[model samples]
Target: MSDQSRLGLINENPIQNGLDAFRALFTSICTSRNLPSTIDTLRQLGVEDLRNLALTLFTSLRNLPVSGSLHSTSGSATLRSVLLRLITAVASDSFDFDRIKPLLEIAISENTQDAQIWDFVSTAAAESTPPPRSIASSLQQTPCSQNTSSFVNSSEYRQNVDPVLKLELEHLYVGLPNFHKSFFGDIPELDMVSEAVFRKCTEGDSPLFKEGWSGWPAGAKESDVLTWIGGLISQLEAFADNRIPTSAARRKLLAQPKTPLEGSTGKRSMDIGFVDSDIIYKPDTTDSRYRWAHILVVGELKSNPKADIASAAWIDLARYAREVLAAQDTRRFVLGFTLCGSLMRVWEFDRLGGIASEQFDINKEEGGLQFVATILGFLRMNEEMLGFDPTIVTTSGQKYIKIERNGQTECLIIDEVIKRAPCIAGRATTCWKAHRNDDPHNPLVIKDSWQYVDRDEEGELLQEATEKGVTNVARYYHHETVRIRTDDDVRNNVRKGLDVTKATNFQPKRTLPSNVGGTVSRISRQGRSSSSGVKRPSSETDAALPPSKRSYSASPTKPNLDVLSNRIHRRVVLRDYGEAIYKASSRAALLDALEGCI
Candidate 1:
C-alpha cells in the first residue's frame, strides 16, 4: 500500500486534516524562530514544510519505483501538495529549509556525490575517463593554472565527497564571497553531470533514466561551458536515443487545497526579525569577480504563482544584489530593509538597526537601497506620467498599469477623464548606454532609471491647457509644460541673472566683463552645498543641447511667463545669502574707511 493510502489519504477526499496538522507545527517552529535543532534535516512535519518535504519526496532512497520523481520512484502522489505550498511559501516570508544553507548544501551535494544506491550512476567515467587532451599539455596551456590552488590536500579533496552531499552543497564550488576561493574546488555543473550520466548508460552498468534539460542557473560562464559540452556530444546523442516515452497514463495531479489559479490558505503574514546590518556590493572585495542575483517585486495581482526555480529566486535575489551593491558602494556599513507592502519601504530606522551598531547609526549612517527603491519607484511613475501628459504628473498617484484579457495598458484616471496609455515601456541602461526598447513586464524585471519620449507638442498642449482655464500653475510647472524650451535658455537665465550677480559681488573691487565666459567661473564660485542634489555646474557644462534634443514651440503660444517666473525664482534663492554677505561687507568697508580718515 502507498504511504498516503497507509496514512489514510484518498483522492477527491478532503486533504484538510493532514495539511492542517502540518501547518500547526510549521507555524509554531517559525514563530519560535527555531533553527533546525541538529541540522541533519529540517523536520518535514508541516503544510508549509512541504518545500523541504518535496526534497525528501524526490530524493528519497527507498520506494524507488513507487514514491519518487521519474528519475527515482513511481508512487509520489504528493506532488500536488508540494507545488501549492512552494508557490505560497515563496510569495510570503516564512522560512523554508530549501532556502537555508545547511539543507540546500546537503541537497546539492547529494546529486553530485550520489551516495545512495538509487542516485548512484556508474562512476566508471568520472573515476577513470581520461582527460580529452594530454594532461601535461592541457595543464601547461591553460592560463588559469598560475592561480590554481596547488596544496592538494587529499582530506580536503576527499571532503568533497559526502555520504550523500558535501557540506558546501556543491554550489560554493564556484565560490561564496563569504568563504575562501578554493572552498569546494567546483560543483559538477549540470551539463558535465548530464554528460557523465548519459555516457555511463551505454556501458551496460547504467540504469535507465528520463532525460530533459535540468534547470540550469542562468548565470555567468555559459560560453566556456558549451565548449566543455562539445566534448561530451556522444553522451547527449545516446541519451537522446534511449530516453523513455513520457507516460500517457500519467494523470494530472490537482493542487490539493487551491483552485486551479490561486494559492493556499496558509498564505499567512510572516514576521522576519531585524537581526543584522545589510551589506552592499562594492569594488573593495578581495575577489572583484563575484556573482549575485537581482529580483523584481511585482504586485499581488501580478505576483507569479509558479514553483519553478528561477521564478522563485527572482525578487529575493534582486534584493540580495541590491544590498550587496549598497554594501560595496557604502563601505564598512551594512544596511537592512523590510520587504513591506505594495510600496518598497525602508526599515533601517527600526529599533534594532537604529541602536545596534558602532560603525554608524540614526545620526551617522545612510539609508540604503530601500531609500533607493522608494526613489526609483517614484521616478518610474513620473516617467510614464510625464510622457503620457506632462500635466498628468501632478495627478500621477493615480497612474498605474492595468492588465486586461485583451492586452496590457496603463490607465490614468484624472478627475473623471480616463486616459489610456500603452503598457510597453523601456528600461534604463547605464547613463552612458542607450535605453532598451522592451516590454516592462518581461517575465524578468530589473530596476534602473527608466526613460520615455514625450511629445514636443506638450508646450502647445500646455498653452491650450491654460487658455482653457488659467489657474493651474502647479500642474503647468510639474509637467514641464514648457519642456520644449532648451536648457540653453534656462542656463542663460541663471548665468545672466543670479550667477552673474554672485560673481560680480565676489569681485567687488575688480570689474570682469559680462561678455566674457565668466559664466563658468561664476557657477563654480557659488559652490552650492550638496543639499541641492543636482551636480555642480562645471566650466565645460553645455547649456545648449543638440537641435534634436532642443525643444521649441510655435503657433498660438502663451507667453513664456512660467519660464520667466522660474528664472526669477532662481535669482531670488541665489541672491538671498549673496545679498546678505554683500551688504555686510559694504557696511564693514565704510566703517574701516571712516576710521582711517579720522
Candidate 2:
C-alpha cells in the first residue's frame, strides 16, 4: 500500500467510455452545469448572421440527465441577464449594432462604482471605428440611450455590432458568461414564439381566436404578440393607482332587480361608467401603465414555487402575452393556465374599476370547462372565482388576451394584461406553495431547515417559506447549503465519505517498492517545506506557526466556510428593473445617484 500502488490502480482501471463518448458527456454536462465550456477554433462569419462557430460548444448527451445541481448563490440573476441578452440578440436577427452589447455590459458590472466595462468598450470603439468610405452615414445619426423612446427606435436600437461593444465583451465574463451556453439546461421550444402557446408533444387544432383573427398570415404573429403586450401594459397602469376601485356595486343585487330600465344591459354598462366606483382606473397615458405592470409581473414570476418554471419557459409566457396584446387589443385580459386547466386573469387599471375575468372552455355552464390552456406554464385561478360570463365573452369584449401558460396552464391572453396582472394588488403576502400542499394528494417534498424568501419593493423579506423545510418560492435558490455538515450524524457520514475519497498512499501510481522506505518529503508531497536535505520541523514547531500559515490543523473539526457564509449571509443583488431604469433615464454620474430616490 503505497503512493505508487495508488497510481497503478488508477491507470489499471479501464474507462467505460471512449473519446467521442467522453467528449459528448463532458459537453452536455458542462453546458447544463454552466461550467466553462470551450470551443476549439473559429470557423465562419456573415454580415449579420452570427453563429458562434468555435465560441462555445457542448457535447450532446445520449440520454437526459434525471437531475441537476445548482451552484449555490452564484447569483442566478447575474447569469440570467446574459442569457436573456443572447436570446434578445439572436431573435433580433441582426448584429450590425450594439443591441445586446450595452445590456450585457450592465449585467456583469461589479458595481456601478468602477465600470471596468467602459474602459474595454472605449478600447473596442477605437478598434472598430468604421471608415467613412464604406460606412453608411446613417450610423452617426441617433446615438443609443437608456430610454425606450430612443432604444426601441429602429434607428437607435440597431444591432450593428459596433466593434466597440464586441471588443468590450470579448474579455468580459459577460455577466453569466456560461449561462447562455448551458447552466439552466435545454429548452428547444423557445426556438419560436408561437411554440410558447402550442404544446410540443401534442399538436392540437388551429388557434381558436375569433373569426377576425383568421386571415393573419404567419408573419402577423408579430402583430398578435404586440396586441397581447399592449393589454398587459394597460392592466399594470391600473394597478399602480395609489388607491384601488371599489367592488362592482355588489352587482348581485342589481342583477335580479325587478324594476328594469329600457335597454338595461347597455345602461348597465353606462351605470358602470356613471355610478359604480369599484375599479382600478386604467391609466390614460401609455408609459405609466406598463411601468407599474412590469414591476408586478416580475415579482410574481420570481415568486413561483417551482424551479422548472423559472427556466426560459416563463419568459415565453410573458412574451407570448405581450405579442398577442400588441396585435389585438390594449386592455385587460385573462389567460388559461397550462396545468389543471384553470383560468387566470389580469385586471387593467383605469380610473374606472379595472376589468378582468377568468377564461372558460367551449360551453356555457359546463362544470369542467378546462379554460386553462397549458399546465406547468402558469398559475390558474379556478373558473368559479373569475365569474367571466359567456354572454359577454367576445374577442372585442374589454380586451382579454388569451394564451397558454408555459406548460403550467393554457389559454391565450393580451400580453399587456399578463404584464399588468403581475402588479395588480392582490393577497401577495401569502405562501402560494404552502397552500398547495394542504390540498389532497400534494406531492411536493418538504426539506428540513428550508425557508421561503419574499422580497418587497424595498428589498425587505415580506414572508418566509413553510416550516417543514421546503422552498415554496422558486426565488429562494439553494443559496449554498446553510451548513454542509448539519447534525452530528451528517458530520459523521461526511467524514466517512471523505475517508472513502481520501488521496491515501494505499492506492499509489506507477510500480513502486512494496516496502515503506521512501522520502518522507515524497509522502507529504504538498506539505512542509522546499528546503532539500533539511530536517522537517517538529509538531511543536509547526504548532508555533500562525493559524493562516499552517498547512493542516491538528484536527478536522473546523466549521465549513460555505456554511458559515450562508448562515451569516451578505450581498444584496437587485432585479432587472435597474436595466429598464438605466436605459430609460439619463445616465447617472454615479451609481449612488439611485440611493434614497425610491
Candidate 3:
C-alpha cells in the first residue's frame, strides 16, 4: 500500500485499521531502512497513539491463523521483529527515563501472557551491549561517585531495573512447583550446624529458655538470636549433666565426658580468641594436660538474610580456620559454624588436614540438638582415638591478618599448613559462567553473563570469565567479598590428619541434601559413610560440583543472546575495592615511593 493509503487506514477506523494494517505497515517500516526518521515520528506521537500501535501489533500476533500459508507466517514473524524494534526504540529513546516509563509498563502489564512480547522486552532491557551515552552515562560519571545517594538513586537504579524486570517476566512463564523451587532453593546442611535441628519455631522470650526458643523466627534481631542460641547451649549443657530429664538415659549422659560451652561476654582478647565468634568452646586452659589451648569451636551469628553469606559468613569462617591451622601450639582441627537464625553452615579446619565436612543445614537432627550433643561428645572423646597427636605442634608458624578496608587483625597460624590446607586463601577477582549438562536430570545452563567482579590484594581481576557465544564484553561489577576455596580444600583437610573415629562420632544422625530447607516432615538416618565411617567429600562429588568443577573444552554453541540474558542467575555486587588503592596515589608519586623503598 502507498504511504497515503496507510495514513488513511489509521485516520478512518484507528483501532480496526491498526489491527488489520499492522503486519503490512510494520513490514514496510522494517524494510524502509529509516529507523532514525521513524524514531523521530514515534517521538512526536502522543501516548494514546503509541498505546494503539502496541495494542494493534499484539492483537495481530494473537489473531494470526495457525495453519496459514508459509509466506504469510514468515511475513508475520518479520512483522513481529519490526514491532519489537519499534517498541525498543521508544523505550530507550534518548529522552528522560520517566517520559516513556509508563508506556513501557502499560505494554508489559497488558500482555503478561504474551511469551513473545516478554521475551522481546526482557532481551531489549538486559542488552549487555552498552548503548550510546544516554542518561545512564551522565549519571555514572566520576563526579557522581562521590555522592553515594545521588549515584545509587539515579544511575544504579536505571541499570538495576532491567534485571528485576527480566526476572519477573520469566517467573510469569514457569510452573508453580518450579517457581517455588526457584524461590526457596536449597542450602547445604552442615553436620554440627543446621536449620533442621532448631525446634520451637513460634514460641519466644521464655525464661531459662528466656527470651528463648527455637527454629527460624521472623523479625528477630541479631542480639535476639544470640540470646536464644546462648540459652539453647546452656540447656544442652544441663541436659548432658542429667539435669533436664530424669530418665535412665540422663544418668548415662552424665557418665559421658562434659565439655563446657562458652559465649562471648567479658573474655580477654588473648584468652577469648583472634576472631569475634558469637560462641566459642575454649580449650580447657585450666587443665595443663591437654597441651593445646586454641579455641575449639568458633560460631559466628548473623541475622540479615539479605547480607552476602558467601563473603561475610564464608570469608570469616575461612579466616577462623586459617587461625587454627596456624596456631603455634595447636595442629588439631578447630570446628567452625556460622549461624544465621535457623540457617546453619559448618566447617572443620585443621593444620595438616585442612578444612572438611562442609555442610549447610542440619536442622533435621532433632532440631540441631542432637548435632550439638554429638559435637560435644567428640570433643570429650580421647584425642588419640580422634587421631590427634598433641606433641606434633608446628614450631615455625607465621602470622597473617584478614585485610579489611576498616583495618586489620593479626592471626597467628602455621605458614606451611596453609600452603597445603584446603583453606580459603584469597578473594575472587574475576568470574565467568558456563553450562554443565553432565547431569541429564539437572542440566545447568549459563543463565546470566554478568559477573560480580573485584580486584584482588595485588589489584588483579578475579575472573577472566566468558560465557558461550557472547562476543561482547559481559557486564561486571565489584561487590561483597567471597573467599575462594575449592574441593581440594576438603581433600587437603582429609589427607593431612583427620580423626576417622572422632569424625564418625561427631557426624549428625541425618544429613540433609545441599539444596533444601523447611519443616522436617520425616528424618532419614541413612548416614553417608566412608571406610572409616567418617563423612568425607567424595572425589565424584567434587568432579560434578559446579563451584569447583572447571571445563577447558572448546566453547560450545552460542545461545540466543537475548534469551540468555533473561536466564535466572543471581549475583551480589559490592563497592569497588580498588577505588581506595588508586585514589590518593598517582603514577609519579608511586614510582618515587617504590624507588625510595628499593
Candidate 4:
C-alpha cells in the first residue's frame, strides 16, 4: 500500500489498523534515515500514543501468524529491527520510554527472528547517553556504602535477571504484609521495663537528659540523636544484665554507630547496628570488624522525621535487611528499625517480604515506653524468637540439621554448603552435603527451600519416582515442612484486626495482550525437576490454591486484597549421586555422565 493509503487507513479505523499503522510509521522512519526528524515525530506523539503504538507493534511481532508467507515474515522481521533501532535512538529519562524499554526488550528476547536486536539497541543506547543511575548509585553519597550484588546495587542487574525470578520478587514485595503492632505484643519483657525506667532515664537530673532527650533540641543531627538513643539502650541493657545474669552468655547487644559491619566489602556500612560486645572491633583497621552473624538488629536514621516509607531511608533499610539475611545462612528473618528523627518503626523481613510496625514518636512518654519495651523485647528474645532455625544446630565447631521421618528423628552433620540462594525474598534455597550421625562415611544431600503452602512436597515426587522404578535418580529418605513458632506468630499477629478493605491493592493495572500471553508456561518448563515424568497438578488447580490458601476466616471482606503468599520452610534428604557435569575429570567422562543421565 502507498503511504497515503496507509495514513488514510489509520485515520479511518485507528483501532482496527493497529499493525498497518505501526508498519507505516516504522517504514517512514526507516526510509527517512533521519534521526532528528524521527525524534521530532516521536516528540509530537503523546505519551499514551507512544505507549499504545509500542504495545501494538510488540503484540504484532510476538503473535505473527505461523502460516503466513515467508515474504510477510521477512517484512515483519525487518520492521521489528528498524523499530528497535528507532527506540534505541529516542530512549531517554522519560517515563514512557523507561516503561517501553523493558517490555520491548522482553519481546525481542522471545522473538527468534531478530534475537541480536537487544544487544544492538543496548550498545547504541549506552553510546547515546551516560548510563542511567541504578538504585545503588543514588545512595552512594550516603555516609556508609551499601553496595552488594548488582542485583541489589545496579540497574544493569535488571537487564540480566531471570524474568521469573524478577516476577517472584515483585510479587513478594507488592504483597508484603505489614502489621501495626510490635513483633512481640505485651510480652513479659514489656512489663520488666516499666514506664518508670524510661521516665527515670530521661529525667532532668539524669546524665542522658543532661546530654539530650529532656528537651531534645530542634535541628539535632542524626549522629547526636543516635548517641542519645544509644545511652538509653545501654542503660536498659545494663539493667537486663543485672537482673538476668544469663543474659551475658547470649552476648551484649551493643549499639555501634556509623560502623561498617563485617561481611561485605568495608565500603558498605549501616548507620547503626546492635552487635555482640564480645567481638573486639578495631574500627580504624583496614579489615572488617563486626560480623553480620554477630549483629542482632540494624537501624537506619534520618534527620528529617517526615521521611516516609517511600523515602531513601527506608530503601537503605531494605537493602541492609537483604544484606544481613544473605550473610546469615541460619537466619530465617531479619529484625530492623528506622529512626527518622523521633518517629520509629520496627521491621521484620523474611522470605515472604517485610512487615513493619506502625510508626511511633519517641519524644512522648507513651512512645518512650514503647521504645524501651522494644529494646527490652530484643534482649529478652531467645534464639528462636530472633529468627534462628532451631532445627539447624551448631555444636563443637560442626553444623547439624535434625530431620524427622514417621515420628523418628535422625541427625545429619553438614559437611559442605553446596549452594545458597542469592536473593532475600524468594525460595532462598540452600543445599548441603551431609552424613547421618550413625553412619558417618556415606554422604547425603540436604536441600532446604521455601515452597508455597499449597505446592506439592519434593519428597513425594521423589518417592513416586523411586516406587515407579525410575533409574539414576536420588533416593528420597525424609522430608518435613518446617514449622517455626515465630512464623506462625507473625501471621497471627498480622491477621488480628486486619481490615482487608484498608489494604493496598498491588495487582498490576496493565495486562499483557491475550495473544502474547505470559511467562508461566516458560517458567514451568524451566522449573521442572529432573524427574519430569512425575505427574503434577493442573494449572486450574494451581490457580485455585492462592485464593483458597490466602483467605482468612476472620475477615468477611474481600480476602484477595491481602494477597501475601505464605511460604512454608521445607527440607528434604536424598542419597548423594553424580557430581556437577562440569566437574568431571575429562571430556569423555563428562559425555559418559551425560549419557547415563539421558
Best by lDDT: 4
Runs in model 2 lying further than 4 Å from the true structure? 1-43, 49-126, 129-308, 330-598
lDDT of 4 by residue, 397-503 (tens): 89998767678788899998886665556567888889999998899999988765655677789888888988989988777666554443224432333322233
Give the RMSD in angstroms, all C-alphas superposed, for model 1. 33.3
Candidate 3: 10-residue stretch with minimal lDDT: 540-549
Best by TM-score: 4
lDDT of 3 by residue, 232-313 (tens): 5545554344322222111111110123212211111211111212323345655422112334444555564433144344
Q: After superposition, how far is residue 388 of candidate 4 from its true place, in Å?
A: 0.5
**Model 1 TM-score relative to the real fold:** 0.16
**CA shift at 528, candidate 3, in angstroms?**
48
Clashes of 1: 23
Please give the ranking of all candidate structures by TM-score, highest first, separated by commas: 4, 3, 2, 1
> How does model 4 score by TM-score?
0.62
Error of 2 at 41 (Å): 5.5
Every model: Cα RMSD to truth: 33.3, 26.6, 21.8, 14.5
Report the candidate with higher TM-score, 3 versus 4: 4
Cα displacement (Å) at residue 391, model 1:
22
TM-scores for all candidates: the values are: 0.16, 0.19, 0.27, 0.62
| Off by more than 4 A, model 1 | 1-26, 29-308, 321-464, 470-598
